[model samples]
Target: MDARFLGIPELVEVPDVAVVVDVMRAFTVAAWAFAQGAERIVLAGSPDEALALKARHPGAVALKDGAPAPGFDAVNSPGRLRSVDLGGRTVVQKTTAGTVGALAVKEASLVLCAGFVVAEATARLLRTRGCDGVTFVVTGEDGQADEDLACAQYIARRAAGTETDPAGYLHRAGASRAAAELTQGVRQGVHPDDVALCLELDRFPFALVAAVEEGLMVLRPHAVPSPIEGPSPIDGRPL
Candidate 1:
């Protein structure tokens, strides 16, 4: 299958399948939440929409830039996900780029969320789904962030039946100028821990299937063939 990367605005039309990537935080957090038993995540194009969705659900969790909104259960941090119980719960997720980009693709045959955690599972599904082509939407600030681009490239390579040490993708992305900026720490308004969590390749074995439901883009876990690495107390195994 042919795979390519496109920025949000550059995508004039959808392809056979569209995989939206947000390696810096958004998708990475979603993968972790699902791993911890989140039933589904609802993606909103804007914060107002997310709040409105929460209003409809009453107790549903809402997040902004990965942090928990008031009255929400938890934030978007993978680390925080480990401390909470999301089993059978629905998550309302709103982000600056990832969710918005995924929802904007009104014509894609299939939409999936991608990052290093679910990259392997997503690639396998892309190939097995009999898609003629796959487009990876890299949600970059200037429509070009290294981390997002690296994730898209990683998925593209995997779909083509090629190999690249997934860790290498993290190394390159971590050193990128965009990612570098986040490393400045929370004092600078960037959470380094969150960024570190995004780099954990293959940390989960489930891919998120995106679909429009009740006017919201819902992302549900599509389990792979195996349990992957079951989260272990020692080191969070089987990713």
Candidate 2:
């Protein structure tokens, strides 16, 4: 399989498999939400659309970043979501980068939203499905999102059967300006533990696959088959 990396969503050219990454928080939050038992997530292009979607599906939970929307249940923070039980509920999520990037790839045969939390699972799924090529979309605009870029690279390496130590990538991501903003409490609605939560590499066992259903981009967790030798090691140690 061949791997190609692209920065920003606008440059994507409808590749066979597209892995849209947002490591600072968006996709990380989605992965944690799924781990917390969320049934599915509907990605909205904007906060207003998220509210509208929530209104249409009365039981759905709406989430966004920064300021709180009128009817949103919560903002996009995996730290805060850690305690919420979302078993069997639909999440309507609108984010600045992640969700937008995932929705932007309208023509890819497979669209998977990813972060370090689901990187390995995503690569495993790609191999299992026999995808000959993949394009990793760094959702951060203008190639400025170092965290997202690191995640895309890590996933690409994993897909190519490279045994990598994710520590270096994690270090690069941790030093990014976005990470500083989150750690310094500059971004509202973000908890102190949000950064740590976002950096937990390969925390989830499934990949978040996106598809349009009834005019909404829906993300569902698809479990990848486990290796016979059990979970792979990270930096020569068990994950």
- Per lDDT, the best of the predicted structures is 2
lDDT against the true structure, each candidate: 0.75, 0.85
Specify the highest-TM-score model's number: 2
Give the per-residue lDDT digits (tens) of candidate 2, residues 1-239: 78877866356367778899998789999998887788889999988889889998868999998866689998899999989999889999999888878887856789999999998989888887778888888887655689998888888888888899999999998998889999998888899998888899888888889988887789988777577745432212211
Q: Candidate 1 at residue 228, lDDT? A: 57
After superposition, candidate 2 runs with Cα above 4 Å error = 9-12, 229-239
- Candidate 1 TM-score, true structure as reference: 0.86
**Prediction 2 TM-score vs. true:** 0.92
Give per-residue lDDT, candidate 1, residue 200. Answer: 77
